[model samples]
Target: MESFTESLNRLKEVHENEVRGLQNKLLELDSERCRDAQRVEELCTKNHQLREQQKALKENVRVLENRLRAGLCDRCMVTQELARKKQQEFENSLLQSLQHVFILTNELNRLQGENEKLKEEVKRLQGPRLKPQCREGASDPPSPLLLPSPGARKAIKEKTLEGQEEAQDDHPEKSTGHRTSPVAKISPSANLPETRAPDVSPQRISNQLHGTIAVVRPGSQACSPDQGPPNGTP
Candidate 1:
């Protein structure tokens, strides 16, 4: 009986040691489960962050595309505007050039006509003088007198008329034009030539050609063969 009891005690000690080992293993397993749960929660949070980042990147890409499109449109508009402005400027310059050419052509034509008329007048005046010069090649040079200007020519004409008047005064029978008062020489057609009829008669017209004025008095007596001058006998 004593040997059996001792064997029972030894069996009891072995069972107790096995139970303690099972309890320690259960605790380690529970700690490992808690750590795994935390790791899973961290993984979930990282996934949510990645999803948000992807959404933001997509929005940025969309914004960039829209900006690029707007910039391209602006560039096209600028180019078109520049082209239009250049075309307008070119047309304006061309128009101005044409106008200038037209004006120059008109002026050139007018100058050419004047030059031709002057050339004809010079030829007419020089024709008689040139013939004599051609006949005598060894003749002495003429004096270097200036061609008469308009004012000088008018003075020369007045002197000629005065000389002719003096010569006519030497012969009373051939006297034509009579000198008149300055008041009588006033022109009636000073401002209204178109409204008045010509006060012309055959004798008055003939007298005008001789630088004379003829006046007709009202109720003048007709001259006959029996008439005599007031200062001379008939």
Candidate 2:
């Protein structure tokens, strides 16, 4: 009977300990549910603030798009057309300048070629081989013969006349047979040297002598001793 009573007491103590363990488990579950509910509330507040920010951003985007459609599109089109025209004008001017430069280059090349040709021609003309040919083609003119001047011719004629006067003086018979006039008796002098007068021809001397003889007529007065015969008498 003592053993039976001791076993019953032991069972009763185990039941009490099990009951305390279940109560502690229920308190832990309740604390976990309360923490979950507080976390849900904080999440809901953050979601509401994010929705408000999204709506404000959408409104701002819509206003900006409307302004772009109203005036900005036309302004951009006009600016694009002006830029295209300026670019086309620049291209045309560049093309014209290129053509002008090409023309000038061609002219310069032609001038340089002509200059080279002229230089070669000048060198050919100045060569030594051409000198003898030029001299042969253009021969030197014959030299003129030297002749006596007018003063020398007159002195020769006077010397011839004096010689003729001396010849007349040597032949007195011929002088007496003649008119004995000073002009008719003229003859060359013996004291003068005998020399040939190349300038005075024989025909010219004979004509002068005949002219002097015919000029003195029988009744005409003789000329003065100082005066000489006129040249036109011949």
lDDT score of model 1? 0.56
Q: Write the per-residue lDDT of candidate 2 for residues 1-234, one digit (tens) a residue.
A: 899989988888888889889888888878887887778787788788888888988997887788687766657879989999999999999999999999999999999999999999898877876789668645754233233344434544664676466555653322223122222233322112222222223343454433333333333233332233556343
Q: List the residue pairs that clash in candidate 1.
A: none
Give the per-residue lDDT digits (tens) of candidate 1, residues 1-234.
898989998888898888889988888888988999998999999989999999999998887788787775557779989999999999999999999999999999999999999999999999999888876754655333334334434443453464456545643333244343221233331111111112223332223322211112122222321223334422
Q: Highest TM-score, which number?
A: 1
Residue runs of model 1 more than 4 Å from their true location after superposition? 1-72, 135-234
- TM-score of every candidate: 0.29, 0.27
Clashes in predicted model 2: 11
